[model samples]
Target: MKKLTLILICIASLGLASCKKDTIVQSANNLTIIKYIEANQWQSSADGFTLSASLSDNRIDDRTFEDDGILVYISRNDGNFYEQLPFVYDVQSYSYTVSKGRIDIDIQSSDFQSAIPDKPTTRTRVKIVLIESSQ
Candidate 1:
């Protein structure tokens, strides 16, 4: 009886040890802007315009593009929602990156020229949304 009780106690201990729950840490930040930038004229040429945003306490430099991701959204008005844009980090394209507390964005006018025609007299408004996440 003593040996059986000892074995049962050992088994219970092992079961309890194996039942330990895993602790997972997760955090996320979302940023939204209505008409972050407005331009008197919309151009359709490369390097015609540039836009940027600064995010504080985002720890962006520590995140890898693969493991972590940055999501971007843009719209011409404040009401309609647009699909998320694919983020690119390259030399020759509309690209963006985050480091420390600042997010640097380069927008190519030619990419959106069709959507936004080159109209000198018309006013253009742009809205942006940025999402950051970590685990």
Candidate 2:
């Protein structure tokens, strides 16, 4: 598809750029940030519900924001301690999206068999990781 091809090209460009001097590639490392979203914190969204956390620690910067990779994990009591996002458990799906200094985790019904549930009535623990390559 044209869109997919364009996305791949853009990603390739960023990768090449990061390999240059004074870029994120030189500082390729992992930075982990943890946050707890209370039962009342999840907010409604068209897809389902989301909880936004601030990247106040500055682990992610604008120069290489798109060049970096983001990983999200969710734990629900025994969601195996923490299962990576875009994973499905108990028919519920989990995922995330990130921007300059923010991360928004989303939850919804996996099969489209049902509507996205209301904000969970229980607390959730999330772990966000950034794989920064550096400028």
Candidate 3:
């Protein structure tokens, strides 16, 4: 009986050791964005807006990584929407607009990579920014 128990314990320990540790795969698929600041002038004279976005690089293969793009759809307080592409060659882009009395900016990632090439299951991080312009 003791021998049987000892063998089972050893087997369990070996099984645990053989299991691979969880690691975050970094990838170019991760996007990053910069945040914008609101200016005081934007309050009265003109409405201004700025924003940026990108994907996170953790859990993705840099080799298979491709340039992630960003698309922004902005909606003003007055119920007007505008679309803009803010990524160029895997880099972040900035957008700005000024009007009479309202500013709105929204940003999101526009591209993705296939996870099957590297492994069965993969994870990634995405980011977005909302900016209210001041100038």
Candidate 4:
């Protein structure tokens, strides 16, 4: 009876040590659409063309754009038929920057014309979408 009580006490001690409670903190996943500009005209210029759009919510400026997160997507479509255009050449390049509550986009007009020869004029519609997330 004494041996049995000792064995049960050892088992109870081991079981109590094995059970532990820990506190875990989780962050909220929030993704917001910072800006959405549609049907923006793509014009021709000597040094390419530039388009600027303001962000609907300036809350993104409060966080670090690099660490927090920022995604920019630009697409072109035919104004007449509203069809998506495929990139043909590698000569065309685009650069974008976000400051304050506005985003500026720069595109090479001559390069764009060479890439999409079908509708190079004012018949091209550009759309810009900006997404931001806080992690």
Candidate 5:
């Protein structure tokens, strides 16, 4: 009888531990940057591009960006991107490179963090832009 009671207690403890919620927010990493077409002209200007794509849990897909810093990674052959001056909240500019078709905006929760006004305690939203180089 004592052994049975002890086993039940252990089981309950395990259940409670497993029930702990994960608070770590995640963001997108893999992004497919599409070119904007207007008047038969591809709008690839610096000011013409926008990273208005929505992110889930601060993640883009498989990419992670930095807040107030620069992150560079390879998405594909000559299809890499870079994000700079990102924030946990508010509208910020993150840049990337595109060659063949479209650019991708990859973001990860691990890339952003709170600074200056104290580390943010909640998830944040970020904006990005695609820039095609003439080089």
Candidate 6:
């Protein structure tokens, strides 16, 4: 019985000593930028008003182009709050589209083709968020 106990203890010690741990850590980053669009900066498109801004760099690569995320937000009250697009407020609808190098924001009346009664007469602040994903 004593020899059997010693043998079991040695086996347990060997098992614990031989155990190995392999860990991999991955990290992801996100980039945020702010752009101010003056009332006059909103251009007229066939559908409605449009605002365009160039990205700081063509930061998005092929990896991001396929799986990354892009978010566009607008502040109606001096940054106190932000509303994400495409959102409908009052009677105007806001939306956006992203490309490799630029972003375009569009606003149209709820009626879709009608002119917005409150076309932006004041400057507007816009927030842009780019998600860089890693695995």
Best by lDDT: 6
Q: What lDDT tens digits, residue by residue, belong to model 6 across residues 14-132? A: 99999999998766688887878777666666543443433343765566667788888988644578899899888787788776667777776767455643557776788888787
lDDT of 2: 0.69
Better of 2 and 4 by lDDT: 2
For residue 80, what is the lDDT in candidate 1? 56
Q: What would the per-residue lDDT of candidate 1 be over residues 1-135, giving only the tens digit for each residue?
A: 999999999999999988868798666666555434344323344544544333343444455333455554544333355534534322223444555545544444445433322322323233344456545
Q: What is the lDDT of candidate 1?
A: 0.46
For each candidate, the alpha-carbon lDDT, in order, equals 0.46, 0.69, 0.33, 0.47, 0.34, 0.72
Clashing pairs in 2: 23-134, 23-135, 24-133, 24-134, 24-135, 25-133, 25-134
Off by over 4 Å in 1: 1-18, 28-30, 37-39, 46-70, 87-135
**Poorly placed runs, candidate 6 (over 4 Å):** 1-26, 46-57, 60-63, 77-79, 112-117
Root-mean-square deviation of every model? 8.6, 14.8, 18.2, 8.1, 16.9, 5.6
Q: Using lDDT, rank the candidates from best to worst.
A: 6, 2, 4, 1, 5, 3
Which candidate achieves the best TM-score against the true structure? Answer: 6
Clashing pairs in 6: none
TM-score of 6: 0.65
Q: Write the per-residue lDDT of candidate 3 for residues 7-113, one digit (tens) a residue.
A: 99999999999999888854443333432333221221122122222223232233222322233342222233333433322322224332222223322222333
Model 3 regions more than 4 Å off:
28-40, 45-135
Per-candidate TM equals 0.35, 0.63, 0.27, 0.40, 0.19, 0.65
Candidate 4: the clashing residue pairs are none
**lDDT preference between candidates 2 and 3, better one:** 2
User: Residue by residue across 54-133, what tens digits does model 4's lDDT show?
Assistant: 33446446554445545455444332332212233255555556665555544543455553322233323344333434
